[model samples]
Target: MFTWNFQYISKARLSSTLKQLNLSAEQGDILIRIHTAIHLADEAVDLARFVKELVPKAVIFGTSCMAVINKGNYALNRCIISVSTFSEATVCSEVIPIMDEYTGTVLPVDMLCGQIKKEFVRDNTKLILTFFSGQYKDAGHFVDRCNDFFPSVPMTGGIASCAQNNQDDFSDDGFVFNEKGWSDRAILVAALSGDKLENLSSFATGARVIGDESEITDTFRNCILSINGKNAS
Candidate 1:
């Protein structure tokens, strides 16, 4: 496994930095995850595209994130590329459409689980990394269902977050991008499988909340209309 955190300027500089990896000569099954806080869909796509062009055989996927957190530290307006090569494991990735285009309906979790299982044996599949758009409301449920289906396998990922728009609305601020393309209503999933594969480990930062908890009295959809009987700021 290898990771790079850098402030991306242009394709020329990106190419120079990527050369450090020697991806050209690197062989074996590989997966490249590109997470960026650039706040632009084009930037995310461009980054993924360049990496995929360099190693077309690798399973490349990622999304625009609010920030990059590594080893307990975090940064914004930067990009992170994580490359993992496996000689004993199998990895597959795809954009799972969670909502119907024409019908405008939220698809069931069954379809999502089907796609993950269809790529590898359910018993052998050991790890799953899923990236969902910030606008995707079903992300939480998706996790729950995956845990129900793949009881032994570990699942991890986060929402693709973006800054609020000028009007303070977050309707379409985030997206998921892969080698093929980017989408807002879909999710990117990578499934790994191998006889020796293990996904029992995980970690978190030392950050914690210290302020007093306030009671919420009312709510409007996902927003809080009032707290402690007072209007929410």
Candidate 2:
């Protein structure tokens, strides 16, 4: 197995970063890490469009960050990307629709397990990575639901970061869509194994506080009316 890595450190206007990266898209696969330093949707769209234009054949997976870190420590208002080629790993990942009826329940678990079996075309999975949006969903609950389905598989990944109407550290909850037309609010699930994957690993970090810390005494479909025995509004 050969370990080849590519790092793109070029300076260009955010509007032209895509063009610059396209200049470097010469081989294998590309892993993208983007920081909008503003809105998650806006910055994500820029990178997604660039990926489609430059590395159309590469499998892209990444999250927006309040602080993006690479070989160094952490950074802000910067887009850091690391490209590596894996000749021995079989990587197949997908995003599923956000189920409205499967919150803090067992139904999502059952559905995910069945889907994984069908998607990867195998029931023997070793590692699974999942992420959910903090805006309209519960990340912890989703993780629990997934565990219920694949109790034996090693799973990791956390909720995506969210700032104000505009925050520098941000990433889309799921796959980038504005450019490639991905589901807007959905959960991303990836299953990898030594046989299918020559190698597999992942990590993430965030500083933006997502959602409210107050308790939800009562609510309905993205609207909460009360908290801690009192009216919220």
All candidates: TM-score: 0.76, 0.58
Candidate 1 residue lDDT tens string, 61-124: 8887667776568776666777777767778888878788789898887777766766643678
Q: Candidate 1: lDDT of 108?
A: 80
Against the true structure, whose TM-score is highest? 1
User: What is the Å distance of residue 47 in model 1 from its true position?
Assistant: 2.0
Query: What's the lDDT for residue 80 in model 2?
Result: 54
Q: How far is candidate 2 from the true structure (C-alpha RMSD, Å)?
A: 10.4
lDDT winner: 1
The lowest-lDDT stretch of 10 consecutive residues in candidate 1 is 162-171
Candidate 2's TM-score? 0.58
In order, what is each prediction's RMSD in angstroms?
7.1, 10.4
